[model samples]
Target: MTQHRPDTLSHAPLGRESAYPEHYDAGLLYPIPRAVNRAPLGIEEGALPFVGEDEWHAFEVSWLNAHGKPIVAVARFRLPAQSPHLIESKSWKLYLNGFNQTRFESRQAVVDTLLRDLAHAAGAPVAVELLDVDDAALAVTRLPGECLDDLDIEVTDYTPRAEHLAVGEEIVEETLHSHLLKSNCPVTGQPDWGSVLIRYRGPKLDREGLLRYLIGYRQHQDFHEHCVEHIFTDLMARARPERLLVLARYVRRGGLDISPWRATPGERPPEPLRLSRQ
Candidate 1:
């Protein structure tokens, strides 16, 4: 596959400041082509190897109900990984802000608008659900896996080093996670912190080396989805796992949080769980 670099997203509203929209305007949404990053990773368009979704949570979602009374609620959006584009974070914030003052006859009206706009921007059918702000399902929970944060290892370089990944002779199936996963936004250079969960069945991965490999991403610059995909790809190349699943739950920023996961065919996806730091 021919490799291509990601386009400079200087025109996007990611690192720039702009006035928020006062009314419902779908034009506020900006779509970044997923191919820009996938190409460099050797992933071809329309032939993704994983089945997953980018799950987004918006906490500041609100709008005016019938009679212009304020209605507040949280929103969850799920976009398939095969989507041609992913909505830029800042632009998504601005797009959602447009509903702040807009009046809708019912909750369904707001949901319909969100579904239509997000699905169009993502270039795939999106699932949008509005939940009460205090919904019990939104409670914070711990990642279900053997935590790797306590591993004592010396790290000199922060740049991603895929060579650090290795596997042992023993075959095993296990789940491992770490809260140290972090990367910068390619356009904004802002830090994005998240917890990563890895589940696989194959040659036992070197736990120390795995932690070192993840820590190396501390200074990497990429989008949340791309970072997760990079980790998945690197592990596949090094460990050659029979079954693999990589999921990252990033902390919320600008009133929204993004969690992306990639898994091999027939692998079960993890449950939607909010991390403590999210």
Candidate 2:
């Protein structure tokens, strides 16, 4: 029952080779306290300015049926932003791999176990949904609003610079997106490609400046959740939007994809729309 803090990154099985477990083992799940990153963002643990969740999609879920035959399915887990901790991505992959040889009576049995273990690790009630590999629910959809990738602009900076974000005097509401969002993994230093969507109300954000601000993350190293929070914080400070929503849909790595969204309170969150890249 030991909880992991940010300093425990070295203990995580992310950049190291690991022996895949052949049976169920919830111990593989590692919880990294959210406060570790929030503190740096000036976000208090209990007094968060935004309400949202991290939606995780796993495509390599598998386990043995009662007859010892293998059953495979995809899974979606919705972890609230208020959760005390966020499950480390690599540890989550390892935990799921542990079910490869485990047997369950029915799909419900598998779901119940997942609910119990994941909720315990998250320190919050996590929504778990298992769907057949070909379920229509897994259909891909496009990101809302306009794509900023086509904007002709120059970008020499690779590090995040919030000052690049500028808002005009005109007030408006719009959704903007960019597929060039890229950041490196803090542990592995591997690139994490994603599409970022920004929806906001208030002063109009300069599209070119917004793209530059996002492009600034190209060489940044951080987790998906932290990156989104950083963007949200920057927008609120520089653009001064009345209401804002920041969503990052990261491409899948190790058979898992994580999409984290943060929004001003009372703003309705969007559906977990699967992008073509996912």
Candidate 3:
């Protein structure tokens, strides 16, 4: 059950060559049911142990203004954790490309449309913001808390093993990060490089074991959101932490990057950051 349920992730667009559209087509967006992956993790949708949103950054958005002038800007989308669906990445890129030749009255109009379409697809009220290219704060932010990679350890297995999570006797609150989180895309089998940040308040997790668990994902294959949820679920099941937050930054693929944040209900994540490799 390490991978997504077959029937849950079925889509014609994925694992296929991209055929970009030249006009606006909300139909280009593909939605995958989240329940498929949650089921394997024993996560009941309503009784989820975490609360957070999936943050998406679109860096190659361009369209026409009212005067047929070209308009370009970066987009930030926040899809709540409660959302029943997660938009497929390839489909998302295709949907955004459809706007390349389309016309909009203003940037707000584009944002409004995105909010509507994405929310409709995700089955939740997704927040969307359009930022100017020169906006000082971009996705280039760094991970918060502490760097777990600072530990010197040995690595042998790349296979994901939840059993490696060992905890100390003391209760603690800390944020740990690692840049070795690597997983392949389920569709294309292409490598997805990511830096993960784990924050929790509970028994102190053994730094060495945590680092090994991250490295275990090296050969894992799945979508970014699913991978993060799997990590959260694995930690919760094994360590039984009182509170947890799993945030991951995957390098851009197709000019888009997805950062998924999942935390205990009503928890806010640390400030945004960009790892050196990102």
**Separate clash counts for every candidate:** 0, 0, 5
Which candidate number maximizes TM-score?
Answer: 2
Model 2: runs farther than 4 Å from truth? 1-7
Q: Mark the 10 consecutive residues where model 3 has the least summed lDDT.
A: 1-10
The digit string of per-residue lDDT tens for model 1 on 70-187 reads 9999999999999999888888898889899999999999999999988887889999999998898798888887999998899898988889998889999999999999899887
TM-score head-to-head 1 vs 3, winner: 1
Better of 1 and 2 by TM-score: 2
Summarize candidate 3's per-residue lDDT along 1-278 as a digit string, tens digits: 01233234565477887678888888777788888878888888888778888988898999999999999998889998889999988888989998999999988899888998898889899999888988876745677778988799999999889989998889998888888899998878899999999989899999999999999989888889989999998888877788888999888878898899888775677765655565
What are the per-residue Cα lDDT tens digits for candidate 2 across 1-278? 32444446778888999888777888888888888888988999889989999999999999999999999999999999999889999889988998899989999999999999999989999999999999988899899899999999999999999889988899999999999999999999999999999999989999999999999999999999999999999999888888999999999999999999999988865674899999
What C-alpha lDDT do the candidate models reach, one value each? 0.89, 0.91, 0.85
Q: How far in Å is the alpha carbon of 227 misplaced in model 3?
A: 1.1
**Model 1 regions lying over 4 Å from their true place:** 1-8
> After best superposition, candidate 2 residue 9: deviation in angstroms?
1.1
Residue 202 CA displacement from its true place in model 2, Å = 0.8
lDDT of 1: 0.89
TM-score against native, each model: 0.96, 0.97, 0.93
For model 2, the run of ten residues with the poorest summed lDDT: 1-10
